[model samples]
Target chain A: MNARAEFHDPATRAHLLADKARWVREQTLAIHRRAPETRVASSLSAVELLTVLYYSGIARITPDEPLHAERDRIIISKGHGSICMYPILADCGYFPMAALETVCKPGSFLGGIPDPIIPGYETINGSLGHGLGVGSGTALALRTKGKAQRTFVLLGDGELNEGAVWEALMFAAHHQLKNLIAMVDCNGRQMLGYTDSVVNLNPLDAKFAAFGWQTHTVEDGHDVAQLLAGFEALLASDSPKPKVLIANTLKGKGVASLENAPLAHVMGVGRAEIDAILGDGAAP
Target chain B: MKTTMRDTFLATVLEEMQASPDVVLLSADFGAPAIDAIRAEFSDRFVNVGIAEQNLINLATGFALEGFRVIGYAIAPFITMRCFEQIRVSLAILSQLRPMNVTLVGVGAGFSYDVSGPTHHCIEDLAVMSALPNLSVYSLSDHTQAPLFAKHCLAKPGIKYLRFDAKPHEPVCDAGNDGLIERGFRVLNAGRDLAIVSTGYMSHVAWSLLPELRAEGIDPLLIDLVAYNCVDTAALEAELAHVPRTLLLQEAVLDRSIENTLRRMAGGKLEAMGVGDRYIFEIGSRDQIHDAAGIGRAQVLDRILQHHAALA
Candidate 1:
């Protein structure tokens, strides 16, 4: 009904984010149970991060006025993995809550990969290595337009392997895009297996720091308290360098069968386990 | 008359950026001498995206969405092939949902980068760019057309690909009062029996054959198709109805080339005068490559004479 900014008392914010994260986790799973086409594991990884952005009102988006020029821009590069946004965007009033039931269905704006047609989404996602560059462009435009809006982008750590991401990182740092904040959901597992075993991006922070970005890391990305702290730091940042937070998260955060599994990226939850998780025989 | 398409294109871009604050020019570290002026004059808007075409398209999409007209310039081969998906997803599809005014300025059309080897020859740009949905393809023929299209593109929206030659070409005819310049296609010379149609550098070769054809008592019509895929097909069809025979010349492969377009519009094979499906692995001049691909002037002239004699 109103602006839901996260600049609240520390204790209250922690408790509120903790409760909201749990609710988002359930809603995300429920949506996946219905759609079945959504990437549940990757979506689960970014639940808290996206939950904090919308529920805490850190993103400066008015659902009714989603295209407000003064609002901060959030470009989610990992579209297929960010299905958590379906429930979050609906809850934020970008669309109706009923739309979540029709995700990946005929005539649903909510597809397997979130598109800009869905309100609250900026640039097109799903394709990797695009968010940072586009966000940097948005940030540059904001400065040129003399508007005070900031640009925030969410990318996957595995996406770091893309050469274009590095190209954008170099450009962002060279331009000193202080108003741009890019956070990587550092869920170790990519589609195939663990990123370390795949391409090995261990010194991510050092890489960003070396590229001249102000870098930070949360030991527990799923912790609402630490996640909020990282967002707060970037929001309050006055540094010339663009800031990046490598939020260390698990691939499949909540589900017992999925979490930390080698093949969690493509693992779909069966109907019985869905009923067990929600404690209801009713279809999502 | 003596400048490359890159110079004229960059010069026009500089002018566009000067007149409007919303026009942003970006490059993937590919630059010309004229680009230096643009970079110096509009340093804030002129960004070198570093040798990365994928990033170039992504940034252009974002900039266009934010109410800025963007131009992403790079070598034709690299930008079109390296970032094909980026262009398809970000620019081509996004433009359908929103008003996107992003123009991709790809230099080195055809074998303009002749010495750069197969890696640099952009013979495939025309085929691939035209295949994308909701895209306007302009295979420009001369330096004059680049600035002309540059002026026109500043006011246009959606995704446009200006396939420019790396080399400069003198005007076969004065382009100032040319109605065909804006009409997408122009009949340079009129004849009853046959017509020669071409785009980019091949147009120059087509223009050169006028005297040769006249000597043979054949003053065939010459049609310069500047806007390839976006050309007015109905109008071209009407023009073709008047001519008994047509020869479509290009530097790209025959598949998805202008001849295929003509076949769809005019309802007959007009003798595809272009390269066929195969790589020119052998290094040579532009003419040598054209000869190897069987689209050389001599080859084209032989085919045209044969068609004219058959029609007679």
Candidate 2:
């Protein structure tokens, strides 16, 4: 496509995206070490999702000009869980990589929750269930303006509990906002316990399909290849309805302690555990 | 045959939309006769987001983020209370970092939805909305001045809340609107004995009490407060400096209404009247409800007479 599409071959791009996903994972954990307040496990769950969107060049971005008119709009709806985006955005040149060190620190834009104050962030986030409605509105505006650019919203599986998300879902489909894309990081865990125990969100794909959305289920969200293929298929579709990728992922995708742990959402990984995980290849 | 504040305001909004396609109007399934024209003329720009106020606000924020001046229309209580967090986070908090132009036009301010019960009465809006920084709150007194405020909303950037009354009344603040948009308030009548400050429908209530106050040898000044937060506070302070006592009248609950603002400005030289710590369940007219709440025309007149006696 454009000069930014570094790898044209799908297989080669998938391999490159896999390497970038790991790098993003290490960087996210490293930042979590410095800023212990970050939701590290939640961040870990979204590594491949964010990595595929940014690295695979499926999203049209102008990193230097964060608010570039012609660029695609990406709303990180689940703000607290997206600390993985810090390193990816930095590496993409939206901001200096050094800024990642000051996350959760005073005067730093990168706080426990990602706000639009940081470059590449599209809206005020962290208050769950708001991004999809806002993204739908943005998508409606673009479609009304007769623009072909798309709007993407990244939401957590637990966030589906908010009734406002369903409102946006209906609005987008009724408006036939084909340019809107929603990716739910189905980590299956919330603050206290598993999402199913709190409130069931299974059959999420069928639910979306019933609401008149084009749905795709990415079986292994941690696999960069699978994530890339899912995104490519959704992006290539000419469906008039809004599209959603139900990316089924573990709450803590990697690390033995957090993986499958019901309370992984609020759990933090200490520096020693991080060092053991990254071990000798931590540098970005 | 009187026109409503919402109709006048939306008529002006329709004109603004006709002038610039960058202006967008969204309703939460709320409709008006004027809105019919908007939907007919510019169906592409108007959206009825069903009966969801939370989504209405979120959508308005999205439109504003995309550089469009947005107007979100809905019932006053549901628009502000039902989706308060959405307004706070998206418009209030987000506008601090981004240049947003969104006007939330909430119909049925105070007891305008008279017989619709307490659920429709929007009494806490002024207090709650003013608590948020960077939000411009406008409580319209009549339909005549609504177009001016509507134009101001389209011209300005940032968040504005236009609290329109559901009922229609004769024009009150109609001295040709000179400097009305800039001053954010207008001095309807002048006197030196006492200054009576009121907003929205309460301004009409206070204005109607002027004759009885003068009949009792009391010279009272009446001011209609339009823009609650960004009013020329210094100028209003200067106007109050001439009067020995200021009386704050409103149709909101006393706990968090503009009464607090005027009390602070008057430096303890003010007596505030409003609905005090209770919801009216009585089925009656607005005046009857006002009387039950102890803020009716007769009660306000009695207070003015007492203030005049104290001045004597």
Candidate 3:
């Protein structure tokens, strides 16, 4: 059965994506309530982006065979900011949903930073600025082997500070890796402060454009429809250049306290606050 | 005829690339004459990532993760030190979880680039590369060992670092003796008095000093330890069992020297000789730089004679 067929209705797909985003946010907060070590704000910033990718049927993945040769590879480079992935992956049957409770606990494979030990994860992450180059390599490999599978990497806006990312940026463009897609969760805030105040990457899209990438920007990253539209257009484009989607997003999108906090990256939501937000949601 | 280890090793890599469709060579803008042929012949598979060492390693890790055997090449100090965290995180740490075949070939061991100044001197690589848990450090002594080590890389499914000397030297290993290469060491000469254990370029130095030591009435054994971590310790222990005293020498710093490992394995019956625990700033020939670093030929002979005297 074609999984993408169900989401062809714009209204129904929008409703389903928005609903999944809400569930993911609630699950993220609930997971943080159990494992405070998880980066809640960073994870929250990327919830919509991840939801669009996993639920929109754009990423070709099989829970039964996570590392299947034909599957499109997704590298969550900003690993610490991807705690939201654990719940979504569990919901997709990548692992037992019951294992979500043991996240960051003793002997659990799920740590604060995700490794390739998880079935769905493609690379060792948490160390920023590694995913793009790795994804480029995979894209190159797939292209070399005459495979049509694409390689996607989710990066943080702050991760662009790493010079290695630029090296890969130059490489992918020069090599004309059209099969590679980079989605940057342009959440303004970094750990200590806003990326603008820390090191201004004000014209993010232009920077990628200047690097010779086919660039796209979604003014409202939280809007699932906008994200899905931007992603699908970029994915479908036949341009020989590598593509990047700059989704300008808000850090700590839903929670008010964290949304305004300068140090939201390190701030953890209290159990009571989480209970208040997700009043009647059952624990996974 | 003498040939640079990089040329011989890369020549073998060129063969591997021809034989296997899964092999890919990534370079960090560091090249040799042999690489020119690879670039011309296998342009599709040969990638020059410019002078970016970190990306060189990360890209190689990406290829290896996708079941491609990767050979990443670069200058010694920059490859091991400039992108250390990348190697640690991507290759060394990631390989523990995934099956990877990535061999990083670092040229210019020790003072091979003597005239290029201190930055090119890769004296600390032995200590740093060997410190990583899962990575094997292959220190090639001569051009003869390069092809074998290159083949060893294709057969192994783990992370490895090949410390190839920039200069060329005559074949040191006897012809048709790959068995010794697999054992990770070769007893160049058997002498009951003293065994001078070394690796890479220092093995050449030890080979040169052998007859002089013998003339001084102190018969010495030369063991070129090629593979740093994948050694047959039982065989090595048996070889060192009868030797009364051993001198561990390397053309590198004494702090965390490869000699330190040999000293431990020899049951404290060994002394280590290497460059002083400081960088050499004096501009001179390789031997003169060695003189400044206190590992010169005369200094090494004197140390060997003193050690032999103490043993007597």
Candidate 4:
């Protein structure tokens, strides 16, 4: 078996990356189609990062079995990117592919954002800057209980404005939670405008370093090879601090009309746009 | 009242942790006296999260998700009002599925912390805690009730808020004879002319006044409402119906304490006797403050007698 076949044959490895990416894109379109009035956009690189972590990295998930005690935790702090999460969850076989149809359905567990009730998702975090604090707590609990389970939290660059995030950062660093890893989806653009324009978290690496975190930045977030390599590096590192992977990504990637679109972060796409982007009857 | 509520709580917590090592304690720079033994015994299990109320609640939530039973300790205001949202999201919502039993030990209510000024006073805690769904609020009437309520809270699988005055309190009820104060208990003589429903230390004052009412040929039913949030509405209504009138005696504001109970049991002609609507402008001792707020034993009896006479 070649490199791709070896990874994709059992369908556990990055073979599902394409399918995960497709699921993310289609589900985002589905959310937009369902709630025409609500603004919905996809996080292209978030899907890619999730694909790398859930597929290739340390996350212990048997597609059929989602709740494994020893399994690594993936907390999505930047919950808006859940448009991508639901599909990736489906691709990982946490739930049926048809469950993706209920993305943001009224009173449905598969809300527009990540909620713990949806099986694979760890914590309910629509409010930004809360995930890190919760992740730190989980890490502390694991450490105290003598468990080796690692927790991975994905945060948006814009969410760093919250002081609670910094409070969590300081605590995590002080406690020396080696089992906790944070990945910032530095997609730059936020709801109003670019992140730099909003809060200017440009000196991101230096900030994490000051906070006593082992920080790394991946220039190409969509590059699966680079993403996987970063995870490997984190797992191997001996640093007595939390790891932060600042994955630089495009807000709306893959789809032509939405890529780097200013409004894509918050604006909704209609049925016509969904058809125009992924083609008709593309979602299975 | 063999064991104080604080002692019972610590004992139960230690027991639970021994069975399930995931049980952890987080405090907001308080509960030193209450949890000293627990801290000494289980050093790794206890955490002093500093004076940050919001951070403490968030940290507790995170710990809960990490498979740890997190118990947060602080004064009533800091635990209930300051970190209210965190409790709602982290404990209440999550406790619906998994056992997110976060034992909040709020030290003192009303005049108990009178010297600490209005900020420290937890007059609105019962009102606030009772309003939130999926939380078990227990206002320990005395030292004995505290431990019983605490152990009950720790053993059960849900979010529980426990309020206790730091100072020594008179033990009113015998938890040993009368089972653990799970629900409200009827004290004094049953089927009295007047019913005085009280919570926390204020119940001690109401208990003291029961004999005085009896001497005047007016037997008063003294009900010690242990759990404010999960008050047995049907049971309380039945007790209320037997009496000619009901008087809610609490250290907290009359509107929140008595009004809340009245709303819950919509049948009784209830008159509230506690701290009035206005903030206490004068500074004094806990007794003086209670006297000023008409929460003293004499004042409460007078209010009950006056209300009873007016109804007649």
Candidate 5:
């Protein structure tokens, strides 16, 4: 596989994006099929972001070999999104794709959240608001070593409430770390209710701006073109501060019945729901 | 006791950094005087994470994850209790295969910072550190012991909590000698009428009172317990067997350190000498708190004589 061939042309990029999105859905469905009891719905939107990065973005990863040093780092700060990340890692070839079947099993590495001991996971994170700090350190290490590798961290909108996250943001911005990019999965809804109802981070762009970060917001997170464009714009900028790509997305994006349904935050898809999402005649 | 222990600790850390380029020193914004020395000596290996205890631990963990041997330095409470979760998760669990060393200095073992109030007093640090599974806790008795134990901690793989008083302590053991490091030594031998088990800076006071006790025909044995967590239980039991009464002296609270030791040697009659259960209400020097806690040399000697006389 020529590394450049995955995203050489616009047409190819689009096809890869669609294929990765489908793969994300299929993998998510597989997680549900394997562990019928696990809560795997809160992070459906994470699948889109993981797919976009792994399949078409700059991370140099071979699914079979996730620990490759030169590969870009993807730290999922929103650890609840493990449901989305584990399958992508399996697809990337970190583990036997079938091992995902043991997710949340009695004694399996694949628990309800990410564990670094598992082949591709970088940091064992289930607690929110820790990824950026770890990522900052990794980015700093890379800079000190003069490595060209970049670090991409996925943070949940709910996690912004934590003061440690902002402390990390300020630290990254003060250091002017251009090699690091932080993406906030702005799904609006949290466990209790909408983000507005909880703490109302209405002007997130200005907040990032105030913190000395180069900030951008996407209206449609599911739009691969926009996601890629935002990433490209970030890569092109020579801004001394770190970048924050605010991806505004629906809670449950792909399946029509589950789209914008807050109940999907904790609800799992059964055989009937899975069939309905895949199509009426789809196999269980 | 002076500032030799601080100097020795800093010097040994610099030496370790020179040998292993991967060694990084993270301070919770303390020890600025040593900064120029470290920078002039080992430039790339030092980071002063300002006052953020949680960030300090996480950053160290991050460095450890990047294959660097990180040493997080701070006063006891800040390093151990403040960012405990980070220590437990990041350094303890993440670096379990080759665990990073986080050396907590300036632990107010029995009111080292008597005037800094309850917050600065690290009385329960031993209890807190001992509870952690993969961590080794050491309370250095004097300045000479600091460097020796530090070198061992740096070379060995795991989390180690090192508690030391900031000021210089009386030379309980010779700096050139490695006897204390290899085997836990009895600095003062008084034929076992009574034994005083001392840790950290208070061991000096315990040793100092031995001559007075011997003059009074109260033979008090002085045992310097260097490594608190890995204490030789058999040796302790043997020492307890000869003495009719044992006095556990510390600079911290009496309950956990002394009480736990006594509980372990159930047969021995133990009297704990240290700070009372309540926080020190009045502000004064370290000596004042030691006096208040009744762990000072005079207080310890009086208690020992009284206990021994009662048994006779």
Candidate 6:
């Protein structure tokens, strides 16, 4: 029996991804409620993006052997903003479902930021602007070692401000690293305020295209179906250039008070608020 | 003696790359005439990261994690300080959990790029690199030091920084000094009272004053401190304790002097000399800059003789 066969077909893949996206949304919010230190709003933005990659059967990974040599590399650069991974990794059997309860607590390897100690993470990612550079190296290594594995790095839109990211972009393209893929969670808001007001990276696609990446944008990154399609096309691209998916998402996707808030990145969700959100049809 | 460190080091790397498929040499577009051959023969493994030091280190760490022995090469100052955070987070921290053989080969030591000014001069690499928890610092003066460094890269599983001089000087070492290199320091010429200790080019400076001091019947120990952070502290301390005085030397800033380091170990008083806090804008030859900084051979010789007189 195909575990993902229900969603394996193009006809149902979108629907399955949508269904999983809701569960991921609720779980991400609930996890934040349990561990108030986790970045809830920032985490919400990448929920569907992560869902599409994992459930669409596009990423070659195993929960049992998360560090398998053949597994496609995934580096989540915005570590603080990637709390959605706690639920996604747990559901994928990367760790016991119960371990999610111990996040940010004593002896829990799952801290506020993801690290290699977590079975699925490729490297230490709490420090921003490292993922792409490191991922380019992994992609180069895969090619040099003659292994057919793609390396994917997840970055925040604001993370593009880092000069190192551009350095990586140039390197990946110059080397014709076709197997390296990046998904920028363009949630508009960084820690301080809107990325536009902070360090405007307008024409993000043109910026990436100029660096020789095969650039595309998902107009509504929150829409799971669109995300699934976007990833499928980029991964299937036979073009020699490295690829980038500029996911145009909101900083805070679901909660009424948090959505589009300038300081959503640091805004914490309380248990009472979490209860109210969950009770109100869990609309995300 | 007249062999440049960059030329000789790259030659050794090229030979090692030929012997193993897993060895990779990456440059930040910083090169030697000899590196062209390695790039030509091992184009697949040799990566020119295009003058970006931060990316160079991250790429090196990435390759090392994937099981390649990577050598990240660039000018000394940029390699040690420009991407310092990357070195601290990626290479140093990562090597603690994972076994990695990643050596950073940084050229243009101290006044080697004298005409190029302070930006090119690496005067603080030793102190800064030594501060990192898991990183090893290899400061070498001559071509004879290549095999020791080669062995570290080929089999060692950790982070290493190799600081090489830009200019080629006459090899001061008389060969067959494995014990000194391995133990990290050696008494080149054992003496009493004061000990003249130095590494890299400063070792030559320390050796120069030996005959002058010996002529005066002042037999201060002439010691060459080869490797940093790889030394057996207690052993080196025991050896240095024999002399009543120890003169620490380096081409880098005064803070990187071995005397400062030894003070932290056994708590001793010592005289220190090297490049001071001020940047060199004088635009002279290496010796002239050292002379301006009051650390040239003549000044150094005067200091040693003065010490001998004080002891007498």
Per-candidate interface DockQ score: 0.24, 0.26, 0.23, 0.17, 0.13, 0.21
Q: How many clashes (backbone atoms < 3 Å, residues ≥3 apart in a chain or on different chains) does model 1 have? A: 0
Computed on C-alpha atoms, the DockQ of candidate 5 is: 0.13
> For residues A1-284, what per-residue lDDT tens digits would candidate 3 score against the true structure?
33344555776998888888998998888888888878899999999999888877888877778899988999999988999999989887789888889887765778788888888998887788889988988899888888899999999998989999999999999999999999999999888999999999979899999999999999999999999999989988989999999998888888888998989988998777787798854543
- Model 1 has fnat of 0.44
lDDT of 5 by residue, A98-184 (tens): 777777664466777666767767775677777888788777767766788888899989888877777678778877888889999
- TM-score of each prediction: 0.89, 0.90, 0.89, 0.82, 0.84, 0.89
lDDT of 2 at A234: 91
| Model 3 Cα lDDT, one tens digit per residue, B38-97 | 999988899999999998998998888888999999999999999998998888878877
Tens digits of lDDT, candidate 1, A1-284 = 45355435555877887777788888888888887777999999998888887777677786889898878999998876998988788877889999888887755677788777889988777778788988888888888788888899999988888888887898889888898999999999888999999999989899899999998898899998888888888778778999998899998888888996899999988777878887886764
Q: Model 3, stretches more than 4 Å misplaced?
A: A1-8, A280-284, B173-176, B255-312
Backbone clash pairs for candidate 4 read B5-B146, B5-B147
For every candidate, C-alpha RMSD to the true structure in Å = 9.7, 10.2, 10.2, 10.9, 10.9, 10.6
Instruction: Give each model's whole-structure lDDT.
Output: 0.83, 0.88, 0.86, 0.73, 0.73, 0.83
User: Model 2's CAPRI class?
Assistant: acceptable
* lDDT (tens digit, per residue) of candidate 2 on B1-312: 478998888899988999998999999999999999999999999999999999999999988998899999999999999999999889988898889999998999999999999999999998898777778999888998899888899899989999999988888745556666888888888898999999999898888887899999998888888987789888788888999898888788765447767887898779788765333434345787799878999999999999889879
Kindly indicate the candidate among 3 and 4 with the higher DockQ. 3
Q: Top lDDT: which candidate number? A: 2
Q: Which one wins by TM-score: 5 or 6? A: 6
* Sequence-dependent TM-score of model 3: 0.89
- For residues A188-236, could you state the per-residue lDDT of candidate 6 as single tens digits? 9988999999999999999899889998899999898778778878888
Model 6: how far is A88 from its true place, Å?
A: 1.1
DockQ-derived CAPRI band for the predicted complex in model 4: incorrect
Point to the candidate with the largest DockQ.
2
Q: What is the interface RMSD of candidate 3, in Å?
A: 13.5
Name the 10 consecutive residues with the lowest summed lDDT in model 5 chain A: A1-10
TM-score of chain B of each: 0.81, 0.82, 0.81, 0.75, 0.76, 0.81
